[model samples]
Target: MTTTLPEAPPAEPGLKAGLKNRHLSMIAIGGVIGAGLFVGSGSGIATAGPGILISYALVGVLVVLVMRMLGEMAAANPTSGSFSAYADRALGRWAGFTIGWLYWFFWVVVLAVEATAGAKILAGWIPAVPQWGWALIVMVVLTASNLVSVSSYGEFEFWFAGIKVVAIAAFIVIGGLAIFGLLPGSDHPASGFSNLTAHGGFLPNGPGAILTGVLMVVFSFMGSEIVTLAAGESADPQGAVTKATNSVIWRIAVFYLGSILIVVSLLRWDDPAILKDGSYVAALSSIGIPHAAQIMNAIVLTSVLSCLNSGLYTASRMAFSLGRRSDAPAAFGRTTDRGVPRSAILASVVFGFVAVAFNYLWPDTVFQFLLNSSGAIALFVWLVICFSQLKMRRIIEREAPEKLVVRMWLYPYLTWATVALITFVLAYMLTDTADGGGRDQVVLSTLVAVGVVVVAVVRQRLGRGAAHDAVTSSKA
Candidate 1:
C-alpha cells in the first residue's frame, strides 16, 4: 500500500539539504538548553526554592506535549516555516500569517537578548572592548557564519551545542557524585539530596510558587521546537522529525530535570550566590571546582552564541517562509546562490540591530518594553501549535494515515488537556500583576498579539478582494 503524507506547498526553490543527521540531532539536543537555564534558573530557584524542580517539571511536560504535537505535523508535511506553515494548512492563511510574524518577532527580539548577553560575558573577559563593541562583534561574526551556508551555521551550532551538552552533563554527573559524598574535595557537610527537603521542606514557598516558577522556566523551553524547523533542511525531514520527537523525553529528563535536581541537591536551596552568580555556577563552586565561574561563563557564552545563531536562522527562515507564501515581501522568498535567504536574513537582522540600539539607549525602559512585549510570544506560539495540531490530525488521517508514524498520545483527550493547560497558564500570567511586575509583559504581549491578529485579518480580507477583482476582470 502506498502511503501518501499530507503535502507541503512547494518550496520557493533554493533551499538545499545541506544539513546532516548529526547536525539535526545535535540541534534537537541543544536547542532546549538555553542561557536561560544557566542564568534564569538562579531567579527561579530564589523564587520557588527547591520547588523550582516542580516548576521545571511542569513546563517540561508542557514542552514535551507541545513538541509531540508539533512533531506529528512536521513529520507529516515538513516545511521551513514549521508550525507557521502547518498553521496555514490546518487553520487558515490568517492563522499562519499572524503566528508566523509573531514567532519571527519573538526570535528577532531574542537575537538582541542573546547578543547582548554574549557581549556582557565577552566584555567581562576582555575589558579592552566596550560592551557595544562586543555586541557588534558577536552579531557580525554570527551573521557572517549564517550567510555563508546552511552547513556553516550547522557546524558552528554543532560545536556550540556540544559544549553546552557536555557542560550540563558533566555538571549533572559531578554534582550527583558530590551529592552522594563520592566526589573528592567536598568541604561542605550540608550537601546531599537532603538539601532538597531540608531547606523548608522542598515546597518552602508553597505549591502555588510552582506556577510562578512555571512562568520563569517556560520561556527557557522556547527553542525546543527549532529542531522541527531545521528538520526541513535535513536530508530526511520525516526521519529527523521523528527521531527528534522520540528523544524529547530523555532530553527533558536529563538536561532539565536531572540538572536541576543536581543543583538543588549539591547546594542548599538557600544558597545566596545561586541567586547572585547563577545556579550552575554556584553548584560548581560548591563542589570546590576552581575557576568554576570562568568555566560556567564559557558555557553561558556558548549557550548565548548558539542561541544567537539559531535565532538568526529561525527568524530569517520564518521571513523567508512568509515571503514564499506572499505574506511578506517577495524578495525575502528569493535565496542567494548558497541557498541562503539573504534578504530575509538581512531584514530580520535589521530588527535585531534596532533592538540592540534600544538596549543601548534605554536598557531600563524602551528595551525592557521590547523584552516584555515579546515575552509571552512563546506561549502564544505554543497555543497556536496546539490548536493547529487538533485540526491537522484529522486532515492528515484522512489525507495520509501512513504519516501517523509520530502520533500524539490519547488523541483528542490529551490534546484538549494540553490546550486547557496552556490557556490556564496564560490566564495565570494575567493575574501575576500584583507586585511581581509581570503585568507589563502580559499586557504588552497581549496588545502585540491582538495587533497581529488585526493585521492578519486585514491581510486576508485584502487578499480575498484582490482575488475577486482578478476573477471579475478575467470574466469581463
Candidate 2:
C-alpha cells in the first residue's frame, strides 16, 4: 500500500519573470564574490596563513550543501520568498515570519555597509563629493534601478557582476602565470608555490586556527543564496535554480579558493605588504602591476556597488514576500504596473538610508550595534534552509516525485549532517570569546533573533484567536 502526503499549499504569487538566464547566471556567479572577498581575505590569510585554504574549503563545502538543499525546494516550487516560503509550508507560519524579517533586516544593514564602502572609494577618486554625498548618490541610483523594473535591476547587476567576475578571472590567470614565472613582470623574487610551505610551513598556527579562520571568512559566503532567491523571478525558475545550484561548487572553488591560493602563493602569508595592502592588491603589486592599488580599488568599488544593487533587490523581495503572508503591511505585497513592489522597495531603501545615517553619525557605537546584531543572520538563514529541506524533501517525494529536479546529495543523511555542521559552528561561535567579535555577534544576533521569534509567536497566537472568534460568531 502507498501513502500520500497532503498537497502542499500553493506558493505565494510569483514575481515578474524579468530576469533572463544570463542575468541569473551572472547573479549566481557574481553574488558569491562579495566585496568582502576583495577587501577582507587579507585578514583571513593573516589569521590562518596558507592554511586558509582549508578554512575556505570547509566553509565552501558547508555552503554547497546548504545551497543544494535550498535549490531542491526552490526548484520544486519557485517563489519570491524562497526559503522563507518553503519554511512556511514545511515548517509553520512562525518559521516563515521570523526568518523573513531577519533576512530583510540583514540585507538592509548590508545596504549601509556596502554604501559606505562604495562612498569612500568614490570620494577618494573625486574628493569634491563628501563621503555621505557619494553614499546618497549610490543608494538613490540603485534604488531607482530597482523601482524602475526587475529587468533594470538585472541589467545593472549583469554589468556590475560582469566587471567583478572579469577582474577575478583576470587576476587568477595573470597571478597563476606569474607564479610559474611566465609573466614578463614576474620579478617578485618571493613568488611561487614555495611561499605556501616556506611561510610558517602552511599550518603555522596549528589546526585550531582553521576553525578560527572559518569564523572570519564564513560571512563572505552569504551572497551565494541570492541566486536561489533571484531564481523566482526568472523565466524558468526551476531550470535557473537547478543550474545555479549545480554550478555552485565550481564557482566557489574557482572564484574563492583559486583566488586565495594565488594570493598566498604569490606572497608569503607573513609578508608586510599583504597585511598593509590587502591580499589582492599585494599580489598584483608583487608582480609589478602598475597602479595596482587603483586597479584594485576600482574592482572593489564595483563589488561594493554590485552588493548594494543586489542587497536592495533582495531585501525588497523578502519584504514583498512577507507582506503576501500578512507577516508585514499589506502595502508591501502590492506591485506597480511595471510589476515592481514599489512600496516594499521604498520601505527597504528608507531603512537603509536610516542605517547609513547611523553609520555616519556614530560609526563606533550605533553602527557596531547594527552590525553585530545582524552578523550571524547568514548562519540562521542557512540553518532554516536545512531544516526546511529535511521536511520539504519528504513532502515532494510523496506528493510530487517529479518535482525533485535538484536533489540533495544524500537525502536525509546529508541534510542532517549539514544541520549538525551548522549547529557546531553556532556553538563554537558562542563559546569562542577568543574571537572577541564572533562571540558578541552570536550573543547579540541571538537576542535579536529571539526577539523576532517572540513576535512571530505572538502574532500566530493572536491570529489563531481571531479565527476562533470568527468561527464562533458564524455558528451563532
For candidate 1, list the clashing residue pairs, or say none.
Answer: none
CA-lDDT, candidates in order: 0.90, 0.91
Name the regions of candidate 1 deviating beyond 4 angstroms. Answer: 1-8, 434-436
RMSD of each candidate relative to the true structure: 2.9, 2.0
Stretches of candidate 2 off by over 4 Å are: 1-14, 434-436
lDDT of 2 at 378: 96
Per-residue lDDT of 212-272 in model 2, one digit per residue for the tens? 8999899999988888878878889999999999999999999999999999999889888
Residues 395-432, candidate 1: write the lDDT tens digits.
Answer: 88987999888999998888889989998988888878
lDDT of 2: 0.91
lDDT of 1: 0.90
TM-score of each: 0.97, 0.97
For residue 425, model 2's alpha carbon misses the true position, in angstroms, by: 1.2
